[model samples]
Target: MTTLSIYQVSKPHRAILQTSDIASILKLLTDAGVPFEQWPIRPLPQNADAAAVLSAYQSEIDRLKAAHGYTTVDVARVTPEHPERVALRQKFIEEHTHPDDEVRFFVEGSGAFYIHLGDQVVRLLCQAGDLISVPAGTKHWFDMGPAPHFTAIRLFVSPEGWVGHFTGNLLPGLVPKLDSAHA
Candidate 1:
């Protein structure tokens, strides 16, 4: 199930609000100016390649492109067996901001996105079918867990792909990672 948890930046150890309800999730995120939605899950082969995954979600992808002026669309997959899973996970777990909005639609598996607002941090656990759009310059970070496993459709305004500007904030380290939060 998808979950949303909000905590004070000063009180990282305690969440002020936490719920798995979809309506509440949408309301909170929408109020925060974060676009959150769910797309219908499409069927795919046992081991679907990027091409297959893209094909399955082409319509939704097209809609997003037209609506957001995204110039590039691609699929990103990370499995536990990936050679650089550790490195890749570490890279994303650090707090960072992008020059362009970061949009992702999870096709399979799950990941956690920690969005840092004014004085609060929103921890969103996005699973399959969840689509999240993080506006440009937002302070945030993602955790794919120690054993990562997910397939996400990503959209970008810049064809240059993901370019993250690291925010040297130790707040991410102060909060629990995906693995620890779940365990």
Candidate 2:
């Protein structure tokens, strides 16, 4: 199951909205101009099956088009034990935003993505079925939590890779991590 939770930003202990159902989640996010959606895919083969995956990615991108106003979709993949994982993971810790909303769909595996807005640290534990939408220019940082794993379908309005306009690096050292109990 997929979930969506909105923290008031001023409050972290409680959520203004939380839902497991995709429709309800999408409805809440879309209405708020925070785009959201899902993708269904068969497992990829050992050989070059990028086309199949890319096709599915495109379909999801199209869905986001009408839902989130993204003009394009860009896909990025990182394995569980990749060498660059640690550096890339930390590089995203500083809260920032794109020109348009930042939307990510986890195609395989799980990662904890954090969005910091005002006072709330929105920790999103995204599994394979999950899609996350961070409203354009929203101050946020993503921790692909501890280990660098997962394949994400990223939707962007531009051709560039993620570029952040940061809100400084005064990140609070203490925050809850992703766990089964919370998810």
Best by lDDT: 1
In order, candidate lDDTs are 0.93, 0.65
* Prediction-by-prediction clash tally: 0, 1
Candidate 2, 1-183: lDDT as tens digits: 555566654444455666777667667556655545455655675332445566766766676688656666656777767788878877776667677677788877777666665565555557886778787787777767567667777777776757789767555234444433443
Alpha carbon lDDT at 102, candidate 2? 79
Cα lDDT tens digits for candidate 1, 128-172: 999999999999999998899999999999999899999899998
Cα lDDT, model 2, residue 26: 64
* Stretches of candidate 1 exceeding 4 Å from the true structure: 181-183
True-structure lDDT of candidate 2 = 0.65
Give the C-alpha lDDT of model 1: 0.93
Who wins the TM-score comparison? 1
Residue 154's lDDT within candidate 2 is: 75
